[model samples]
Target: MKKRVEHGLERFIFSSRWLMAPFYVGLIGALVLLLVKFVQELLHIAPNILSLKDSEVILAVLTLVDLSLAGNL
Candidate 1:
């Protein structure tokens, strides 16, 4: 009886790993979306860099940095 209980507990512990799979997939999806946004922001800023005022350019650069930090996390 003790051996049977031990075997069942081990099986449960092993199978529990599957429960975490969805979380991993979700995190990957979010990161991919973040990357897409980052590229979009870069493209948006590039062509306008020369026309933008100093303050506006600074703000745009800061926004890119923020997105980069978020992706790293």
Candidate 2:
């Protein structure tokens, strides 16, 4: 009887994985937001890339690095 109860409890706990589905969905949304921000940064930098001085380029690269270092990094 004790062994049966233990197995039932294990099954019950395993079935609870669905409880985390929404959290995973939220993470997906967060990733989408990050992707959009990176695209916006790219658009903002595209036009000035050629004319940017060394210091300006460094700043832009740092911005990209910062974005990449988010939890996804």
Best by TM-score: 2
Superposed model 1: Cα runs more than 4 Å off: 1-11
Which stretch of 10 consecutive residues in model 1 shows the poorest summed lDDT? 64-73
lDDT of each: 0.93, 0.88
Clash count, one per candidate: 0, 0
What tens-digit string does per-residue lDDT give for candidate 2 at 1-73? Answer: 9999999999999999999999999988888888888889989999999999999999998887788778374
lDDT of 1 at 41: 93
Which residue pairs does candidate 1 place in steric collision?
none
What's the lDDT for residue 55 in model 2? 97
Model 2 poorest ten-residue lDDT run: 64-73
lDDT, residue 62, candidate 2: 88
